[model samples]
Target: MPNSANLGHKKKVFDLFAQKVLVVVGKGGTGRTTVARVLAELGTKTGRRVAVIAGTSGTHFLAKEDPLLSFSSLEPGQVLISYLYEHGLGQLGKRLSSTGLASIISTAIPGIADLLVLAKIKQMERSDAADLIIFDAPASGHFLRLIATPKGLADIAAAGPLRKQSREVLEMLDDPTRLGVAFVTIAEETPVKESIETMKQLKKSSGIVPCALFINSVLPSIPGNEKVQDLSFLESTSPYYQAAKYMRTRSQSQKHYEAMAAKAFGLKPIEVPLVPTVELSEDDITYLADIVELQIRSKK
Candidate 1:
């Protein structure tokens, strides 16, 4: 029998995994892919089967590094084709794939491609393909459009298979137990501003709030009891002193943005330290994952 404490810990872990889909969203260059990969790594490391459905290209590289991870990218065109066949419209699917009709249809119906992708994700969830599925969604504007697709269609599509499918996807999006959004951003002016605004837009449009916020690439504070202002005293023409001064100033700026985000989101943002490397390796990802896991576990 599990002890009460152990049971509580398991419950916490289960709660995190219970949300079958985690959509990682942020501004472009805000490290959304890295955060998504970290979440995938955390799930697999915890012994849960995981899949990553990347909205952008080159993400399969993560899966290549981790044998336990499953990665796939959804091409809107292909997803539309597969969706038709799944509904017993095989001939139509083939015709569209071969001809320009697909483009015409996609262009004619706004959000059709995004809706189809959501449908595909919904299908994956129902099939239990993995214990957790991390969707590395497109950046701000695109992500807003993506999640809003189902609701948009449900309103316009009044009474048919289209309506039914749209409603179903909307249900998945609204169910907190089934879907979670992790918003990632760097502690810079534009990204921070965009992050808060996008999250508010997400809530207003979809009625789904983000489950977590991550401030990526945060610089560590300079050691010692010296105040931030005192760091200026060490300013010199030497490259080493210049580098130190730059880091201190940036670190101070990061703190200010982090606080601003925390206040707006009403949730303490998880700060991911900047890894001192040009290109992050698999081990760096794992190290970051461990930090996130530890923080989450501690919270529990």
Candidate 2:
């Protein structure tokens, strides 16, 4: 049901290796997390030291205890949270004061020390190691604020170790070779519009362009032919014929909507089909990986 006019146009969604850091953004319930996980897996498959991190308080939900999961059958170092209060504070204290003095203060005021440590952890995560770091950032509206945190903290600290750390983060954010943002959305009106707006804001605020737009749950356009007509007719004999017809119609409508949304946003949309279930098994993930690999191969 996609616009027949836009059927064969190719989009680049998987050619992301050129980017050092990639942030995926989208409206809620648009499969942003799924896409982020896939990209992280792909990065790891290529033997890159990849780190996946959630950008908000919701990190606990996405990654419970072991924040990282291996996808390529190879076990790697665990992914650590970028906001560990105690450990971060310890590192900051070591940088700020002598080991003996910092240790004494840390013991005396553990609560305050932990709070300071947490901030430093976030700063280090934003600017440190790993060939590819994937950030499952907050939804579009709040993602911008998260990205702006370094600048905010920099201004607050002014002239201390915190300021220097924040500056490093800001520098990483501004470097094109160090960062890229991905916008994910469904083939729906509101999400698509929000994605466009998010892109505009991202460019204005960060001066970094999004490398791709992922159109999650895209309905493929099946050409009207004898086969489709036969399938359409076969539904007439069933009690649920009406439901079948509705599904077919809905699919077509969704396709057209996605096409228009992609055109309006001026982004080459990468289509990911809708699956029947919410919980994707390893086989399902493999199927998706194959699809993505095909898309990447086609681009080449």
Candidate 3:
């Protein structure tokens, strides 16, 4: 139901939520967290139960007053305790997780911490605790490792409980109808190139391509740069003309990279306008969410 002629050419993100898990990823500093937060806000506003999880502190980004959202940070010890408490081992969970041995054990398991992150997310979705889980997964390199963990375990553990658990996590991660990646990138040489390669590695590893590509912080084309340029006398002397020309040049560069990404990844990148500010409030986040929401809403 997404409306943009550009977005209409690809899968609407709202449709992807029906599968329940969205992993937002990109190179560091590409606003992956920003994208995850906006997606959570928009999903909550649209009446779905939403959870936002990150490896860092939850209080760092989420507003507690919002009842529609549940936020959590990924911590192995806490997850182990929570898992134990759920299965009627509350006293044992608390005592063991409180000790240093729990940390040491988690470290010993190659990807236990990250796999628990996925396990917790899928459990929340399956239990109907949330209609959608937006995961602010680590940047590209680590994300690939996280998804590959279960498979690696499956390859090693031929049989028994660990094998069974690994298979379950593997199925959940590869369930494209539900779990998918959203690649966020800025319009620049390195990020654009990295995005292309990341998408390739993701598909190669999990057999799932990106569900969406958000070209964040795009500068708009300066209005009537051509007309202004036509005034030959103003071209040299006018600051207005120079600024317009600069903007036009930059906008074109963005367009070129955008095109390259589309051709390489076969996704129509959603061009989110640059919000020129150092700091953002809840209202600003909502405003940005509105921009994204416009792309995925039903045409009806």
Considering every candidate listed, which one attains the maximal TM-score?
1
* lDDT of each residue in 160-261, candidate 2, tens digit only: 454565566567666767677777888667877776776676666666667776777765454543144456656576755655556667776676667766
Instruction: Give the poorly placed runs of model 2, Cα more than 4 Å off.
Output: 1-14, 56-129, 146-160, 220-244
Worst 10 residues of 3 by lDDT: 1-10
Instruction: Point to the candidate with the largest lDDT.
Output: 1
Per-model TM against the reference: 0.84, 0.68, 0.81
Candidate 3: the clashing residue pairs are 19-178
Model 3 has an lDDT value of 0.71
For model 1, what is the alpha-carbon lDDT of residue 124? 93
* Model 2 poorest ten-residue lDDT run: 72-81
Clashing pairs in 1: none
Whole-model lDDT for model 1 versus the true structure?
0.73
Superposition error at 4 for model 3 (Å): 8.4
The digit string of per-residue lDDT tens for model 3 on 1-300 reads 111234235443444465688988888788877888888888888788888888544436745477789887875456754654665666665656444554664566656556666676767767877888888876536546667444665653355444666666778777887788788998888999988987887688767778888887778655585576586767566887788778778777777787778677787676667777877678878888887777656342
TM-score of structure candidate 1: 0.84
